[model samples]
Target: MRILLAAAGLVLVYAGIVSLVSPGEPAASPQPWGFGTGVAVRPPEVSLSGGLYFKTYLWARGGGGVLYLRCYVYSRYEGGTWLPTPEEYPVLGVYSVTVGRGPFTEGGALNLTLPLMGGCVPVATPSVDGLQLGSIKVLAPGANLAASRIGLYVAYAGGRLGEVTSFYGPGDLPPSPEDLSLPPGQAGVLLALARNITAGCGDVSCKVERIKEFLKGFTYDGTMDAPWPHIPPGVDPLMWFLQNKRGVCVHFATAFVMLARASGVHARLVVGYMSDGPVPTQWSLTAFSPHAWAEYYQPGVGWIGVEATPPMGVTPPAAPLPRETPTPVATTPEAPPASPGPYQWPSIGLGVFLPLAGVAAAALVGGALFKKRVVIAVGEALRVGAPRGFWVYVNRRRVGRAPVEIVFDKPGLYLVAAGPFVRVVRVVDYRSMAGRAFEKLLKKLKLPPSATPREVAERFPQYREVALLVEKLRFGLRANKEDYRRLKEMI
Candidate 1:
């Protein structure tokens, strides 16, 4: 009894300390990391990222077969202006996003280069009840498998797409996340264009509409292999695209993200396939199908996705030819690309190295650190895969089966057994900073300590469904998938 009491007291102390130390770190929406899903957000020098998915099956002439899936993900905008990935940024001065490897996770894995070193992308599998399942088996005849077929599937968070379409600026705009500061000349051109494109538009929504409409003019060239741009070899492609005025999805999306960021709107470039495309009854995909887009962040709501390129099956007219200009070498003068958008092409990012050391770098002037170092969340549950499911046990006794959900409030012994082996589990809670965000939202809504569903619905009609679910959660109705869906929408 004495030992058990002492253990409980320590756990309580630990939780208190975590609550105090981890409260203010910024965290955006729950974006599951992906293979090939990264971006290079250097102000005038940026690069995009992209990925493709494939699966193949092998068959023998006489009897059997085998199947395999391939996931290829790359996060760099190859051939962009070359900037070395800095080994480390000053921690205190510049908010850092540290990407660390997690525990013995399974499935298709690959080693990536510097820019891609965030987290592994989540691949999809046949799943139920938020659980993913896969397996492998061996057969006697290995080489006999000659005749083979392949399948291709694009894994994406479909739920993320619709969320982007509904952009709701907060009634009371909160602070925007940390972001890259644009050079003065660069900021001038971007803000001028935003003002012109969003002219007569009273609000953010109108501004976004005008900007999207203006961007659609770039058109989907579908010519990914076309030479990037005629600017000096080191100039950013989108900057060239801005002056030349034509490109594929990558060019359009990249330009939109940069413009949005410069216009005081926080944004990011996302690279993934069009998972919701129409395909043949048989599993298939094409090289021309890889795609990219942009998402801008809202204060309390999170990142919202939007399309800057034209919809599929709609191709625009060809681009106008750019005037000939001498190539710039070692600062020797050369006329810039043709079709300039607004300002004269300012010599923004060319060899202009801002000294990032001493008080200058230590000041953390333009850097924005919006994301937190990834951390494990308490009460998070994961399923152990099994054919007929597996048994869940507690304190040496069987409690239930594989999908047996458990949220440990205090330290305890737990187990997940599959056939002959039993994996012992030690349960503990990991604190996170999201609770502070929710509290801010609540305070913004001006609700009391015990806000009723009616009062909540009245305050936030947009989240009437969420308000109802909160009431249900209060009454001990376990939060389900629907609750999570609602939370994503409301938050």
Candidate 2:
């Protein structure tokens, strides 16, 4: 009884921690489309030019897996409020890249000197120069009214794939007109079913069961398959339905509304957080819960909810603890002593195992300690006049914002700074080419090679290191003359 109670207590503790650290199960309500996908690193440009352009450069790529890319642009008219730019209808053409096997193709630059005749229009200006994708809604396309919002963002800008060159003004935008329309019968049937479920299902427990029943009829194993048939990329519930039957509540809600409408049910999908837990205090990582469910109008219960998906399945990963009940594995017995050795401290195997165990423990502790130190150090650094609202670019790619200190694994010349402000620092200088040259110059001045420009400035703020370096190089006329002569001779 004691062991069982202890196990139960541990399980409860673990569940609570997970809920606190990550987001809880979604509430039965509507939510905005949280399209989370990796975008390619836009090539390094000194700055963005003011005009309409195709912001394409391979958004997401997975090994042998279908890639879904979500591009966000913030746009505004000069001297006007931020206008919501619509999402784009991307038409992809796969080609083979010569470097390796699979569909990798040589990409081209996004030229913007042509007429833009697509649905997309340029939101950038001299002062207002960004894309506004906040209100841009992306939904699964279908015949139903709800799915109608999931139309092509803008139409194709350039001509077909390779011939694509320039972009005109968000040229004559296309209308939300499609030939394949949904029939009234199908839409009505799905809406009716949704209304019935929303009206009847009262609580989370009841909704979970309802989802189980709904999905059981579709998938034999109750596990969904992938590559949803007849659905557009990134805008289809059918994609999740066909992919993994083992998705969480979001998958169920999406699929439920989609399938219902397909089967002649008048239903619309909604996205919102479930009112399960208390509201968060701040917009921290824990506050963002991408929840989704559906609601339909019923005669009896106003706008009722049909929770096609409830919270279930594997939980998101966070800080983990050891299992309450550790499973024992079979082990081999120690060998007998070969000879009568006097005063043997430990066997070879025991010595090896104990040291290794110590090392593993130390490693775990070291990692935690290191993380704590870094976080604290960064906090301190940020407080000391750390530039705010600056962009961070590494290897000519804008990866993050400032005040950020990025520790790169590979050593090379790394460009780090906030937007518009930049400093090129060498991550690793095993070659010692630049550093050695600078150090030698310092040594000739009877100073230690370790006295770098940054160090000197810290010691005496008035003597700007950059200015001093410039002066020193200026004084070394013979060396400079020799370098100039070499260059002149080469020319």
* Number of the top TM-score candidate: 1
lDDT of 2 by residue, 373-394 (tens): 1111100111111456654433
CA lDDT of every candidate: 0.34, 0.28
- Alpha-carbon TM-score of each model against the true structure: 0.32, 0.22
- Prediction 1 global C-alpha lDDT: 0.34
Which candidate wins on lDDT? Answer: 1
Candidate 1 segments exceeding 4 Å error:
1-180, 183-185, 224-234, 279-288, 312-491
Residue 103's lDDT in candidate 2: 27
Cα error, residue 209 of model 1, in Å, equals 1.4
